[model samples]
Target chain A: MTDYSPLLLSLKVAGISTFFVFIFGVFFAHLFSRKKFFGKSIIESLFMLPLVLPPTVVGFGLLILFGKNGFIGSWLLNWFDFQVVFTWIGAVIASIVVSFPLMYQSAAAAFESLDARMENAARTMGASNWRVFWTISFRLAWPGLLAGLVLSFARGLGEFGATLMLAGYIPGKTDTIPMAIYFAVESGQMEKATFWVVIIVALGFSTIMWLNWWSRRNIERYKNDNA
Target chain B: MLEVQIKKKLPHFLVDINLTVEDEILVLVGPSGSGKTTILNAIAGLDHPDDGRITLNGNIFFCDNEKPLPTQQRNIGYLFQDYALFPHMTVEKNIAYGVKKMNAIEAEKRIERLVNTLGINHLLSKYPHQISGGEKQRVALARALATEPSLLLLDEPLSALDSRTRLECQEELQRLHATWKTPFIIVTHDMQEAEKLGDKIIFLESGLITKTVDNRSGKMIC
Candidate 1:
């Protein structure tokens, strides 16, 4: 029988990482969309590095920054008795770093597409900037924002190379589905590898299908609204 | 009284204008890019001027040397040409948006009164997308007036309507102005619209007030 611990671990890590990425991604997207300053492109490019670089390269960079005796890792270990390397937390961190760009890009596009006049109208109606964002901007951009979240969750679920490099495979602990599949194939357990592959493919496919349906529904609604 | 003596430097021209308005319909008649909308924006605190002061009902709204009060605190209502209603909110909620500081009962009463006054009582539950252009304009007007602003600015308010609807909307505006007695500054390029609705019309050319026509007497005042 194939152990499902890898699946459970993968879910936990992806769920938590997606949540964090959602919040930070939306905040950064709003910031970048509304404000302009010097070196803005450089800062945006830095956030997008993980999307262009190899997953293993991202993992290697994370390891250098968070490994024991590393600057942040040493401080965390000494002050909080915390260790992220070779643990599920490391997997979550890797997932967050890799999936953030997707969320940010999607949210930014949605925000930029919104009419600034709507926001100005809200302000003239005595709505504060914070209130305008929540009641007007966020509401208008929700469909795209939701699409971003789903994409990030899918990306996090399929995260492999970074998870493997940073949070080394350890069955029932840090071993996620992707890592489990790798080890199963290496050990000649074709059935186990195939099972894991099927589950991942099904989850990924459903998410993409749902996203497509949602986008189509949004387009139809917009057409009907204008018509 | 609303008093404005402001200069704003645009890319191609300098807007230097001095104007005063009372509890009457003051129309700004000018071509596109003649600074009519910019004047409204400056009063609404949506645009800043290079130098000048704006005062309404003894309250200073903007001064070039000091940080201008933000738009929300200006107590000025603006009706955009497109009737910029919040698409996600119901008509009632949009009307009640700026009146959140009022007690629930008071807010409800205020919304009911405005909706009834605007003949939009039936549209209270409908979203902006579900309403017609004329209905949306009424809803936008109701939302703008719900806060009890000291002054109202209408930017090309009738430009988005068809001829029949525009005539109806102009009559409605006249009725509302007579009843509410709140000062209104309306911008329009149509000379007939200005004559029909404006008590005083200010002709603008190249960001300057070229002439002032008192529509009541059909005589040039300045």
Candidate 2:
């Protein structure tokens, strides 16, 4: 019997991490798209670093930061009796770090493409900055933000090396789909490995297909001005 | 009443302006890049002046002594060239957006009256994309007026419309001004349109007010 815990665990980690990525990604995207400051380009490049970096490199960086002897890890252990390494929470952290850049880039593009005059008009209409963002900017940027959501979620679901280094696959706990597939392949469990591979492929394919369909519909909606 | 004394360094020239508007239409006529829109923007608090004092109805909006009041607190209605209507919202929602904090019944009544007066009563449920250019202008006008701002700024308001629609909209503006009685500062590049609309006309060149004509007596005040 093929155990499904790995599939369930992967979903749990991806879901939680994607939620955090979505919030922070959109927030930063708005800030970077609208404001100018000294070192703005450098800060934006740092945010995008994870996207270009290898998953192993990201894992190594995170491991150093969150390891028991590391700065944050030692403080957390002493103060809160918490250890993130080799836990499901570690997988979530790895997923968020890897998936964040996808969300941020999509949301930034969305926000940048908006008409500044629309926001200016909202301000002239007596809307506070927060109200303008919520009522006008956020609603206008939703299509792009949604695309970011799907991309980040997919990236989170497929995250591997970071989870391996940080979470250290343990069956029924930290064993996400990618981790399970790696071990299964190594141990010559061809059937188990193939099952997980097919599952991940299907999830990824569906996400892309849905996004394509959604964008097509949006285009058609805007094109048909009479409707 | 609205008073503006501002100087801002533009790319081509320094924009030095001095103007006062009572409850009347003050038309700013200038070529592109002559800083007509910049003056309107400064008054609306969308742009800052290098040195200036802007006061509307005795409330100081911008001065050297204090931080400039933010755009939301300025209570100025600005009608943009493209209308800048919220595309995601229905016409009714766009008009009601500024007045949302009012009692629901009062807001509805105000929007109702605005649409009726603007002849946009049938467009309440339509999105901006589904409306014609002329209809969109009226909807934008209604949205700006719904807040009952103390001052109104129109930037090339009728420039996008057809000649026939422009004439009709010009008449509509004249009627609306009489009814609303708020100080209006309108920017236009068309001299004929200025003559039709202006109580006082200011001609700008190279960021300077080269002429100020009293439209009522056809006299050059400056």
Candidate 3:
């Protein structure tokens, strides 16, 4: 049975992944929502690829490109000492790749629901493009932004297949909670596996409860403001 | 000063409109899809006129496919048809949304004046959906005036209000026209509203300006 340290590592992996996923997801969603350019649909498709592709396939693709001796990985390792494979960072990268679509789609829907004329009004008020977005567009989209963050965080927490392939279970060094659970169950350690599962179950349930509470608060606030 | 002579065509509707209102309310009165709004849309740089020119305060704002200054660069204000106040914004925020970039004191003073002048002081903390249609109209008016625009474009300000409130809003709009001495361009289909609020009325039918009524008498009438 894997010890508690590996469970802690999994939590760290999920946190890091959620952060990166949220940043990139929102950036792309903003780009797609407010801008017009050539091949915009293609950019949209690439961002959404992870949602449909099997996580294992996504991990293998990353492995091919970022493995120790793989094309980009070997050069990055020798030049920058930034090897990603078999590392905690690698697990975060895989998790971010897998969970990105969840965040992006939610944020895009929120953005789409906004009235374009409101932004136009802000712009005419002598605000720069970025100012209008941050002050008005983002404020209007806050609820949906929270939704995206929660979904991505949840997906990162449950990440297993991609993390396994990209950042193989290395006990406390690289293994995360899901990976640790898998290893424990494989090695006939039911008690340890069950204990870890209980922890995860509690964590997930608490997070979902918090999300639900926050969501309701926002919805009610919106209703009151709109009334 | 505002001078507009623009020709634009949509598939089923079009606007070949022309007007020059130096410093008075020039109302474009017409029914739905009669192209009254399109003329205002063109002036605000919302739509492109096929082959005419629009100059405001001596700046060539837009000309038939010429350099189209975006809606932002043009110092023009448009009050939306249904009072498209930002639903997510507070009445105060919506009014301030377009003027917060002004100096802090100037912005606050302007917002205060607008809120008070429009009789929306009590509704400042509320949002568009929270407020009634009359309140929304006043809020929209406040927002439009906060920018101190060189030209104000109003589209059916009283049309969305209930019958009882429409008369009250009409008087309020009349007071506003008297208070603000800038060029005002209003659009509505109701003849009574046009006669009541317009300094000069231009009638449009199927995108063509078919009649013009100058408010030479300058009377407060309904």
Point to the candidate with the largest TM-score: 2
Query: What C-alpha lDDT do the candidate models reach, one value each?
Result: 0.91, 0.92, 0.82
- DockQ for every model, please: 0.67, 0.73, 0.45
Candidate 2 vs candidate 3, TM-score winner: 2
Q: Give the least accurate 10-residue stretch of model 1 chain B, judged by summed lDDT.
A: B100-109
Clashes of 1: 0
Return the clash pairs for model 2, or none. none
Model 3: residues with Cα > 4 Å off, grouped in runs? A1-3, A69-71, A224-227, B9-11, B47-51, B64-66, B100-102, B127-129, B215-222
Q: What is candidate 1's lDDT per residue for A1-227, written digit by digit as tens?
A: 65789889989999999999999999999989999999999999998999999999999988988899888888899999999999999999999999999999999999998878788888887899999999999988998899999999999999999988889998888988899889999999999999999999999999999999999988776453344
How would the docking of model 3 be graded? Answer: acceptable
True interface contacts retained by model 1: 0.69
Q: lDDT tens digits, residues B1-222, model 1?
A: 999999999988999999999899999999999999999999999889999999998888898789998999988888988877877788888888888674878877877888888899898898888888899899989988888888989999988789999999999999989988989999999999999999999999889999998889989999
Per residue, candidate 3 scores C-alpha lDDT tens digits across B1-222 of 888888888778767777789788888887798887778878887777888899998899887657888777887778877776777778888787777563989789878887888888999888677878888888888888888889988888787788889999889877887888899888888888888888788888899888777776754332
DockQ computed for model 2 against the true two-chain complex using alpha carbons? 0.73
> lDDT tens digits, residues A33-113, model 2?
888999999988988999899999999999999999999999999999999999999999999999998999999999998
Clashing pairs in 3: A226-B130, A227-B130, B7-B50
RMSD of each: 1.6, 1.6, 3.2
Q: What is the DockQ of candidate 3?
A: 0.45
Q: CA shift at B137, candidate 2, in angstroms?
A: 0.5
